[model samples]
Structures are given as structure tokens and as C-alpha cells.
Target: MSLKQQLKDAVAKQKKARDITREDIVKNAAAIQRSRQEQKDLSNRPH
Candidate 1:
């Protein structure tokens, strides 16, 4: 491929990787929040 095409492909790949990484971050944050809430709830419950 030409240099221009190669650059375009590289940029596209980078964008895709960034989007996937963003999604993973969001998912992990949500899971961590849920886990924290569960722990808090368990601690507050009567034993």
C-alpha cells in the first residue's frame, strides 16, 4: 500500500483500539462500583 494508505490504516487501527480500551475501562469501573456497593451492603446487614 502507498504511504498515505498506510497512514490511514494505522490511524484507523489506533482509533479502534482506543474505542475498545475506553469500553473496557467503563465496564471495569462499573464492575468495581457494583462490588463496592455489595460489600457495603453486606457489612450493613445484620449477622
Candidate 2:
């Protein structure tokens, strides 16, 4: 499954037992984007 789908599934699972806000999803998505960008940047740098 795709990462986005996995994220949504995770949030849905948590929602079943607790509260999850849109802000939480936004924050997590932002964090993932930042992390992916950092990995890409590192990969492009000279060894």
C-alpha cells in the first residue's frame, strides 16, 4: 500500500479509540514531507 494510504489507515485506527484532529494529520504530513526532502537532499550531495 502507498504511504498516504498507510497514514490514513493509521489515523482511522486511532480514531476508533480516541480523538484525532485534522491538525494532527496536517502536522504529520508536513513532517513526512520535510523528512523526505531531507533524504533527497542528502542523496544529491557529494560523497
Candidate 3:
């Protein structure tokens, strides 16, 4: 209702959004690492 409260709510929402983005980035990085490792393993296997 108040201006101060509105600003606080906006800031909180932004922080939550940033946290979710960070989590997504970490998960993506882990997935990429796993895929690279799997590729390396496949390359080393004999045909």
C-alpha cells in the first residue's frame, strides 16, 4: 500500500528471481560438464 512497502516487495522479488537464475546456471553448467565427460568416454572406447 505504501511506497516504501512497494519498493521493498520489488526488491525481494528481484532477489528471488536472481537466486533462481543462479540455480539454473549452476544446473546447466553441471549438465554440460557431465555431457563433456560422457563424450570423452565415448571417444576413448573402441569401435
Candidate 4:
């Protein structure tokens, strides 16, 4: 294989990894938002 082909393959792999990481971050953020909203709801209620 050529050097250029090797570089292209490496770049593609890096991009795929980055995309997966970004997706995980977005999912985690949404979960955190939901948890905070739930906490707020609980605190507003009287015993």
C-alpha cells in the first residue's frame, strides 16, 4: 500500500472515533438534564 492510503485510513478511523465520542457526550448531557429536572420537581413538593 502507498503512504497516502495509509494516512487516509488513519484519518478515517480517527474521525469515526471522534463521532462516537461526540454521540456519547450528547447522550450523557441529556441524561444529566433529565436528572436535574427530576431533582427540581422533587424539591418543590411538600412532605
Report every candidate's CA lDDT. 1.00, 0.89, 1.00, 0.99
Off by over 4 Å in 1: none
Residue-level lDDT of model 3, residues 1-47, one tens digit each, is 99999999999999999999999999999999999999999999999
**Count of backbone clashes, every candidate in sequence:** 0, 0, 0, 0
Deviation (Å) of 24 in candidate 4: 0.9
Model 2 weakest 10-residue run by lDDT: 16-25
> Each model's RMSD to truth, in Å?
0.4, 13.4, 0.5, 0.9
lDDT of 1 by residue, 1-47 (tens): 99999999999999999999999999999999999999999999999
lDDT of 2 at 40: 100
| Candidate 2 wrong stretches, greater than 4 Å | 1-20
Question: Number of the top candidate by TM-score?
Answer: 1
**Model 3 segments more than 4 A misplaced:** none
TM values, all candidates: 0.97, 0.56, 0.96, 0.86
TM-score of 1: 0.97
